[model samples]
Target: MSSFLGRGWSFPPRFDPRTKEAVMVADETDIAESLHILFSTNPGERVMLPNYGCDLRRMVFEEANEQTVTEIKELMRKAILFYEPRIVLNRIEAQLVDPLNGKLEIALDYTVRGTNSRHNLVYPFYLHQATHPVRA
Candidate 1:
């Protein structure tokens, strides 16, 4: 029986060159991978899927504050709701790790659709200035 029998099909299906077998991902691991991809990809980076990806990167360039945190949460909500059909968001929180350095931490709580399983994930991102001064 294929390893993918009970587990759902893996996204971005990979294959082992040596064994010539498809790599299978299931459950939490697969969801985590999907979330990572969702967070890492910048919007408009995907050719045909222009609306895909999160705006978290853009938020890094902005000043980190209460408003920024709220914006981040909202962006997360919108992006997740629109992109991931397999999970439903339960809560999202964002806090400034260092306002001066434009570092922020985000926490997301979600439940997999069709199942009662719940999961939480935290992500850290740094937004640096577009231009930096050169010290002599």
Candidate 2:
């Protein structure tokens, strides 16, 4: 029983030396395609990503913030160009909090992204959708 549990298949001696030559590296096009395949415009558990050198920090938007529709759209545009997120949803949330536990108030929620590891077989794709509004 012990032998059977430990026994496993072995590669041929001639092919023993596994080289990195066979590994196919991903390029810009490959990454974009992978993103498309992973994220859908409409779905569940949409992902949030960190791009533009931004870290994965908690986001909280204050209602008093002077953010306009145009600004939000512009930010979305830039994000689309840079990270190529699937799309931005029509809904947005607003709140005020100290994410870093500092005295500053932030105006934003979370944004999703696709991959973390460069060598990951599947790149992560982000999807942004406005969450459903709750009734009082």
Candidate 3:
């Protein structure tokens, strides 16, 4: 049942030394990782999927207030509605962790569609981003 959730390469790309194959994640773990990727990306990050993300990068300059929380939740809702067809979202919550540090904890509660399994992923968001990124 969970097979419908699908599997993908792990973020940052790990590999097994013996097989020399990329590490993959599946089931609820895959979903959680996908959520992280979706939130981490900006709309134009992917050239093919121009409208694919929640635009968290743009929120870096936003004040960590109620409106910001509302906006973040809405963005998550829209991203999930458009990209993720495997889960039914239960609720989204953004808790201000530290305004001075510009951080928020975003919790996403959802149920897997084919398996009827409930799961939650808590993602820590930081509004403070480094200016002038150094290309490595």
Query: TM per model?
Result: 0.74, 0.21, 0.90
- List of clashing residue pairs for candidate 1: none
Show model 3 residue runs off by greater than 4 Å: 131-136
Sort by TM-score, best first. Answer: 3, 1, 2
Q: Which lDDT tens digits does candidate 1 get at residues 1-136?
A: 3233135435556678999988877766677667767776789999999989986777657766688788878877888889888788998887777777876778889987756678998877666655322211
Please report the candidate that would top lDDT against the real structure. Answer: 3
List ranges where model 2 is wrong by over 4 Å: 1-64, 67-77, 99-136
> How large an RMSD does model 2 have?
17.6
By TM-score, the best candidate is 3
Q: Which of 1 and 2 is ahead in lDDT?
A: 1
- Tens-place lDDT digits, model 2, residues 1-136: 1221122222111223476233232333344333332222222234553234221111123222345323433443344455544222333332323324322221222232332222212212111212211111
- Stretches off by above 4 angstroms in model 1 are 1-23, 129-136
On a 0 to 100 scale, what is the lDDT of residue 102 in model 2? 21
RMSD per model, one decimal: 6.6, 17.6, 3.3
Error of 3 at 114 (Å): 0.9
Rate residue 99 of model 3 by lDDT.
Answer: 80
